[model samples]
Every structure is written in structure tokens, then in C-alpha cells.
Target: MKRRTVLRGLAGSAGSIMTIPALAQDRYPERPIRLVVAFSAGGPTDLMARRLAERLGAHLGQSVVVENKTGAAGTIGATEVARARPDGYTLIVAVSSSHAIAATLMRRPTFDPVKDYAGVAVLGTVPMALAVHPSFPARTLQDFLRVAQDAPEGLSYGTSGAGGIAHLSGELFQREARGIKLTPVHYRGASTALQDLLANNIPIVMDTMASIAEPYRGGQVRILATFAEQRSPYLPDLPTAREQGLPGVVSNTYNAVLAPAGTPASVLATLNGAVRTALADPTMQAFMASNLVDPFPDPTPERTMVFIRSELEKWRPVVQATGLSME
Candidate 1:
């Protein structure tokens, strides 16, 4: 055969071989799917992941087991999933901390959130609250701002960690609340922060509603404002920061499902469709609302990527302002 004909035959064979895996994905996820959560088993992230696992497993006809590989503010488990095979068997249940805030906040990152993962579904978001010691003398968000602005020194607030979403959200809030600035006093966890706030060791604490819901209800701490766009169901009488004065200071941590970057488009479609269906279930919707987890209107993969990118951009200024860097 001529040289051109031989080259054509070799190219065709290569193309055929390359298409095998993509074609095989038509019957994808034959075995159990591993959903990795980068936090402990009881936290909001883990809870969300487990709920999603049940929904996804029901739809996909496979047990979606949740495995916790906790550490690094959600980068450890994320790294494991980023290195996983792209056969749709391994996925990461990533939060805004890992995918957005940490992507820009951490100086030493384990993986690239945008490059190493493909969006499967945008799970949901939980708005944060700015809580204060009950005796701090602020009845509302505007009152708190006035007190903070008039303070002799920088008012300090507590957060779960330095580079986590809580800290970044606090920083963002400080930036938006002109003439009023609050410094973060980082702790090992939200419980510790709450303890400090209760003891009046710290005047303020910023954390997700899941962490502070009980405290706020029990009157242990006064929620000055929520970062939600509207009223929280749990605190219907309470107004959001936007409702008070600062309109651009809303912040929340969200969960998004992602697969290894090279996963087949067909496999991704299967996973996304299953996730959308699961989240749409009335039971899931009720659960999410009660838990303060708001579902995305459009959770498609394309929209998910755009949302992730926007989150990264949104937190970049906060990171720059706070000068936070995690090990």
C-alpha cells in the first residue's frame, strides 16, 4: 500500500481505539459510585452529600456511598476525586469553600477547582448569619454597624477557620459595610466560636445557618442579620443585611457535585439528569428549605461551571482584602 494509505489506516485505528471508552460510558456506573465529602460525617457538607447520595443512588441504580476524607478545608477529599478515574464512578461533593473561596484564598492549593473537575450538578446553598453576644447592645444589623463604626478599635468576629467561607464572608461583609470594619478571630471550629461568643469572649460570630440555627432559636446568641437575599424561614421576623442597608454583602456556602475532568460527556449528562430529578422531589425540596439549603434554579453542568467561575471571581477581592493563606 502507498505511504498515504498506510498513514490513513493507522489514524483510523487510533481513532477507533480512542472511541472505545466513550462508547463504553453508554452503560456507565455498573458498580457502586463513590461520593467523597471533604468534611466530617455530621457537618452540613456531609449531610448534603449523604442526601444527594440517596437521591442519586435511587435514580442511577447504584449505591452512591459517601466517604469522608476530611482535611485541608475541603481540599484533601477534593484532591482524591480530582485524581480519580474519569469513568463516572468517583465524584466530589465540593462546597464553595473548596471550589471558590479556597481556590483564591489558599496560597498552597492541592488542586485547581476549575481545571481538575467537571461540574455534574449544583447542589444548593446555605446562607450565613452574623451573630452577636446577646449583651453586645445591638438590636439590629444597622445598630450593630453603628456600634462597630464607633468602636475605638477594630471590632473582632469569630470564624471557623482563617480561609474558610465564614472568614471570607466576614471579610466581604466588612468591605461592604462602609466605615465599619471587623477583624476575624479564627477558631478550630464553629462550636468553639459559638462558645466564645456565648462567654462574650468574642463580640460576633459568622457561620452558616446550620451551625447557628439552634443557638439563634435558643436565644444563646442574637443574629444581627442574615446574608440571605430574603427573610429566613426560621427567623421570619429577622431582616437580611440587604433589607437593612448594605445590599451587596450577602454571602453563602454552597455544595456542587463534580467529576474528574476527563469524564465522558454522556456520563456527565446521566449524572446531571439524575441529580436534577432528585433535587426536584418534593421531599428533597422541603428538606432543603427547612435546612436553609436553597436549590439552584438551573443546575445544569454548563450553568454550574459558570456559577463556580463567578463564585471564584466574587471572592477574589475578599481574599485580597483579608490576605488569607492556608497551609
Candidate 2:
């Protein structure tokens, strides 16, 4: 009889403890929620976060505010989110490098990417196009490679940041083209690099289509190829890097949301629902396409994890070759 009583007490305690978080989740978002972006406002990530916030508010019946915590190549913001109270009140919008590349790049990474956070769902990838200045003489990808092979010196290209996707793309292009030598010029952001490209200060730049689409259309820059798996419908006339013979050059900039580790699973489900609702709207799709973002196929937990892991593995070699740094 004593043992039976003891067992019952323990089971009751266990049940209550499990029920607490579930109950709290049911009442979650009784207040405003904070969505942290690891970069400055107006960047691709921030723009997407704001759009999601607007639609998520309608779905959740709560305000989702976006806060930019820029600096240290997104480290400051990521670290903040990792340490936040896991009450579902605070979350983060992360990118490819922030979670994957930063994990290995930073000498003393602030938090473990997989261990310290729970992925919400991927937002999508921002497609990029490789371009050069109009004055560069080579009008074709083949012609450019031929010239690059012949010179292999003083040729240079610009990327958003050192050890970033843009930089890695440039490096991968160099490695694949074999004999095409180019110096990499790193900028704090792609905007800065684009400015130099416009002035003819830099010969080449690998950046997002959204960032350079207008300029390219206006003849301010010459697009070499789109770095996507397939030709973008929006830019249907352009060929993918792979189709142009650079098989290793197709890449995209990814964006996703993640909650601080230990957030209640029930809360996560509710938040996921809001994300799905927002991402499914046709209006959102049009907006993303206009901005050169390819809306992800599905925003589910399983898909998000698979995407992250695949991206990590895909870029492992590039990251190793470039030796990118967070500092």
C-alpha cells in the first residue's frame, strides 16, 4: 500500500510538470512578441521579418515586433536570441551564414547553432546573379573565362563580407574555373560593393538579384549568370551558372526563424501555424518574387531541419577553403 501511494505521487507530479508548459502555451502571446533580426533594418532578412510580422499578427492575434541587433556579423543578435528566456516571447530570424557558417567561422562562437535553439521554419532563399561592369569587354561567360585564364593576375571581384556566402561563391568560381585568378575585395555589405561596381572601381560582384536587378536591367551592370538551381522565372532569359558550365556555382542566400532553446513545444506549434498562414498568402508570394526571394516549398519543422543540415554539409568545403571569420 505504501509503495502504491509513492508511485501515484510521483506520477501525479510528473503529469503536472508536463502540463504546466502546455497550459502556458495555450495562453501564450497574451502580450507583444519580439522578433530579432541579426542584421540592420532594411536588409533582406529585416524586410522579410517585417512582412511576416504583419501577417503573423493577424494569425496570432498579437503584435510581432522586429528588432535589429546588428554587428559582429550577426553574432550580437544571434547571441541575444540564444540567451533569451524560452517563453516563446522572443525569437530570431537567422540566415545561412549566421547559423551554419558562423558556427565554424567564429573563433569563440557565442552559442551552439543546433544545441542552443529550435528552428521554426525556413522563410526562403534570396537568389543572386553574378555580374560584372559593362566596361569589362567580355560579354559572354566563356569569353570572360578565357580572358581570366590568360591573365590570372590583378583581376578582382567584390563580395558583401569576408567569409560570407558571396565571398565563398567568388572563391568557388575561382577554384572551379581552374586558371582564372582573381583577388577578392570584401565589403561590410553588398550595397557598398555594388557602389564600387557602379563606379567601375571593381570589375565584378556576386550579389543577390534583388540588389542588382534594377541596375542590371538599366545596363548599369552586366549579368553573367544566375546562381540558382534553375533559371528564375522572373529572369527567364538568363541562364543558371551550372548551365553555363560552372556546375559548382549555383547557390542561394537562405533565411529562417528560430526560437531560443527550451521554448515550449506547444508554443512552437502555434508559432509554426502563424508562419504557414503568412507564407501561404499569394500577396506574400508576389512580394517575395518582386524582391528576388524564392518562397520556400514548405515551412515545416522537418523541412527546416533538413534544409539547414543540407546547407551546412553543402558549404562545408567552401567554408573550409575560404577560411571565413566572424571576427
Candidate 3:
């Protein structure tokens, strides 16, 4: 009877001890959380982060502050977040350049995109488009390939920058098409590339749907193909590269939230719940649509990992093929 009593008491003590950690985790975000945007203010990524911070802050009952830590093609902010505490206080607003492409592009990377962080939420995906200035000869994908194959010294396409998703999209497009040879002309930014395209300095430009929306509406540029697995809802009439016969050319960049690896699972669940709730809001839906982002309803860490792995696989071959590396 005495031994049984002792065992029961020990069991009760262990139960209480385990509950303490849960109690602590349940009290997470007692203070404001910092959201790091690895791009400059007024940029697409910063805008998305700020919008999400507002809704997330409201849901968490805590301030979710967005700070721009731009530089090194978004590595500065990413490194800062990767080194922050795993308490879910500091997180990063990651994009394709910072999270997916940088994994294979950077020659001397200080942080590992896969190993150093845990996913909090996936905001949405933005698709890349192949557009030609008004004066370009080809108006359709079939015509564009025919023109490229026979063009003198090959045709050239401008991208926001070398090794960016758009550039990789172009590379993937060329590889999949076999005979379509398109040279890349890297620019300082997408705006500059789009401007050059508008001015007819560049015959072709690979840009995101968000950046191409105005030009596409004004008929200043012809969208030859969208580089997504499916057609964009905003441009449902436009065909994806896959539908146009190049099935291996899906190049999309995602905007997501991530925290330093080892963050408590409870805290991750809280964040994912808040994000999924915000995405389901009608107003939020409108905002994402306006930005040309397709929201992922289920924003879980597992989904984020699957995306990261798949993107790495897709971009790795392109990077190797182009030898696109950064110092």
C-alpha cells in the first residue's frame, strides 16, 4: 500500500511538471513581435509584410512590427532572423530570392534556408510572366519560339536581376523549349527592366504578374506565357507555360513567414492559426488579389517545408545550368 501511494504521488508530480511548460508556451507573445522584411520599404515584399503584420497583430493582441533590413539580395534580414531567439518574437518575411534561390545561388552563404529556420506561415505565391514590348514580333508562344530559334545571335530577355526567379524562369523556359535560345540581360530592378521593355530597349522581359499588370492592361506589352503550373486567376484567359507545351517551366516566388529553427511547436501553431484566419478574411482576400498573389489556404510548417524542398530542386538545375552565383 505504501509503495503504491508513493508511485501515485510521483505520477502526479510528473504531470504537474509537464503542465508547467505548456502553461509557459500558452503565454507566448506577452510582448510585441518583430517582423523582419529583407527588402526595402515600398517594395512588394515590404508591402505584403506590413499588411500581414497589421492583421496578425490584431489576432495576437500584440504589436507585430515590420522592420526593413534590406541588402545582399535579402540575406541581411534573413541572417538576422535566423540568429534570433526561437521564442517566436523575431521572424522574417521571406521571398524566393532570400529563401529559395539563395540556397543555391549564394557562393558563401552564412545561413542555411532549410536548416536555420522554421516556417510560420505561407502568405501566397506570385507567378512570373514572359512579356514582350509592343514592338516585338511574336504575339504567341509558338510564334515567340519560332522567332527566337531563327533570330540572329538569338533574342535577349531582361530580368530584374540575374539569378532572380524571373531570370531562372527564362532559363527554365529555354531549357524546356530545347530550340528556343534567349539570352538574359540582368537589370538593377524589375521596374528598370519593365521601363526598358516599354521603351523598346529590350525586346523581351521576364517579370512578375504584379509588375506586369499595368503594362498588360494598357496593352503596352504582350504576355507570351505565364510560368505557373496553372493560369493565374487574375489573368484566366492567359495560358500557363505548361499548357503551351513546356511543362517543366513553372517558376513562382512565394511570400511567407518564418522563425528561427527550434521555435516551440505551440508558438508555431498559434502563428499558423492566426495567418490562416487572416487569409480567410474577405478584405484580406481582396488585398492579396490586388497584389496578384494567390493565397494558400492551408499555411502550415509542413507545407512550407514541402514548398521549400520542391523549389530548391527546381532552381538548383537552373542555377547550375546558368552558373549564376553571388559572392
lDDT of 1 by residue, 14-100 (tens): 999998876778777789999999989988778888888898899989999999999777788888999998889999888887888
Over the full model, what C-alpha lDDT does candidate 1 score relative to the true structure? 0.86
For model 3, name the residue pairs that clash. none
Model 2 bad stretches (over 4 Å): 1-17
Q: Which regions of candidate 3 deviate over 4 angstroms?
A: 1-18
lDDT of each: 0.86, 0.84, 0.87
Quote the RMSD, in angstroms, for model 2: 2.5
Q: Please rank every candidate by TM-score, starting with the best.
A: 3, 2, 1
User: Which ten-residue region of model 3 has the weakest summed lDDT?
Assistant: 305-314
lDDT for each residue of candidate 2 in 1-327, tens digit (9 for 90 to 100): 999999999999999999986777788878999999999888778889999999999888999999999987788899999999998899999887787777768887788777788878888887667799999978888888887888836478899988888887777778877777878899988999999999999999988888999998899999988888887778788787889888877678888888988887778888888898898899888888888787787777667777777777777787878765656
- Candidate 3 local lDDT, 198-264, one digit each (tens): 9999999999998998889999999999987788888898898899888888888899889899999
Error of 2 at 73 (Å): 0.5
Clashes by residue pair, model 1: none
Highest-scoring model, TM-score: 3
Error of 2 at 43 (Å): 2.4
Q: What TM-scores do the predictions have?
A: 0.88, 0.89, 0.93
